[model samples]
Target: MIEPPRFFSAADASIAVSHLFVRPDMLITLGFYKRKPGLSREQFSQHWREVRGPLIASNPILSKYLTRYVQHHCVPSNGWPNVGDLEYDGFSESWFDSLEARKEMHALPYFQSEMIADEHRFLDMKATRILMFDNQVVQVGRDYSAEIAAGKA
Candidate 1:
């Protein structure tokens, strides 16, 4: 089971609060993938964005069930810490109105076969990971240091 984030009272350090609220009606799936062997990261990202993204967006059934879709491409940076040899090429997020909608979408033969087949072209299926959750936005800004320092956030 997925554990909810823990909340604590500022006045009492020992006090623990639970905020387990989630949008059960909606389902958001995040898919992380590493490019298939022998394929350059550029090739993988381009194919996903140019070909796969358009294909999914144009699908009538998929477009109907999917509420939102986003692609996150990883960029190499020297400042970031390197953890072992494992590297992720990118990730994609798909949001559905409900879990039932997602189930109905997958039940379609086109989604079950064609979509899966297309995914294999650029993605290393064995190295992919998928997580389902409801997204919660806490903050959105460039500067939150002041608020954090004052304990207002």
Candidate 2:
């Protein structure tokens, strides 16, 4: 018999959203920058909370369609310098306006050039779009058997 794949133990978080703005033929990308060594977690958290956090926070396009979920230890193999588990939630016709706005925002010199330049401290970086499915999709449930004097799956 085969066993289930082991999950990662260091998932930063997961942002699931419809790729409504990017062109149908163009791939919707998720950019992740690696954290440079000697960077403390607190410092890392603070930078996002104080700087980048506001940018993304203020973006009506992202706020409206993006859903951020906490994922602890979800990418064990993706070390500190790696960006793990980038995802796309497919497309939705209703998000066309938001998508257009996002494209325009990305085209901005401040975002495209400056921000891109500022994020080069990380170790590993990667990006991908959904052509097939992704990492395991697991569902949680109560282990009724444990309580009933039996067991589980």
Candidate 3:
């Protein structure tokens, strides 16, 4: 009898996401003019262009902190690439002395002002799911075949 080496499952690589709201400005800027039918690639590109800068700017301080504390967040990349059904949502986090820090961010006028639903309107998407990620690993490969072969992923 032969035994096969145990490998981690795909779930092991998955991360949790929470409260993902598309920024309103991103909707129009993304040229996602239609609220019905199907989502288009043109719309996706526009959304990224409009939303990325503000999203990055809002967390400059947090980005620095996350780079220091989190391994995955520290990777230097202007944008993330997609693989099949999976999308790399990028990485970021905040370091706080207490929950008060979080509350302060939420209570900020700017944070409160942006509406996620309005942004998702173009896609006609009424619902969004948030997942929470605990443990995660970074995997990279020129091709899918290499990634499957290396358990390191």
Candidate 4:
């Protein structure tokens, strides 16, 4: 079994409960980004979290299709194994009802012209990678298992 992380703040635990269940057909993508050469990590993270996040959320076309969005900023870890030397500055996750919804969202002219253009402001486009997945929530707090199993999660 995969052990849960040893530490979580009260706020984090609450958020964890909200995501205890996963939609098997949900289209989820993890977008890893490298900071632009001249930008510091803080600068890149701020722009993504403050500017880009609000921009995407405010866009009518883009917001309608998104089910969930999260930004994960990377922090240095001590004593961690390093293999390839490749490191991502941060990652953003976006979810949709299906893969087709993602395709349709991108097919919009505004997404191609505005969204892609905005990304270039802080991301090293050449170093970015996007991985898609169907999410599965394997475990949650012990008290919530019955609720989740009852389809109320």
Indicate the residue-level lDDT of 71 in model 4.
90
Taking the candidates one at a time, how many backbone clashes does each contain? Answer: 0, 7, 5, 0
Error of 4 at 143 (Å): 8.2
Write the residue-wise lDDT of candidate 2 on 1-153 in tens digits: 222222322263333433212223222223333344566545545554555556555666554444331212122345656665533211111121233444565577667664455444322224211121122223245424333443222
Q: What is every candidate's alpha-carbon RMSD to the true fold?
A: 9.7, 13.6, 15.1, 8.6
C-alpha local distance difference test of each model: 0.73, 0.37, 0.35, 0.75
Off by over 4 Å in 2: 1-33, 59-103, 121-153
Q: List the residue pairs that clash in candidate 1.
A: none
Model 2 residue 53 CA deviation in Å? 0.7
Tens-digit per-residue lDDT, 42-116, candidate 4 = 898899989889888888778778888889988766557763433989888888888778888999998899889
Off by over 4 Å in 3: 1-39, 55-103, 115-118, 121-127, 135-153
When summed lDDT is taken over every stretch of 10 residues in candidate 3, the lowest stretch is 23-32
lDDT of 3 by residue, 6-96 (tens): 2334464343423222221111000112222364545543553456335545666444322222212122244655524223222224333
Model 4 lDDT vs. the true structure? 0.75
Q: Locate the minimum summed-lDDT window of 10 residues in model 4.
A: 1-10
Q: lDDT value for candidate 1? A: 0.73
Sorted on lDDT, highest at the top, how do the candidates line up? 4, 1, 2, 3
User: Could you say which candidate leads in TM-score?
Assistant: 4
TM-scores of the models, in the order given: 0.70, 0.35, 0.35, 0.74
Question: How many pairs in model 3 have backbone atoms within 3 A of each other, for residues 3 or more apart or on separate chains, i.e. clashes?
Answer: 5
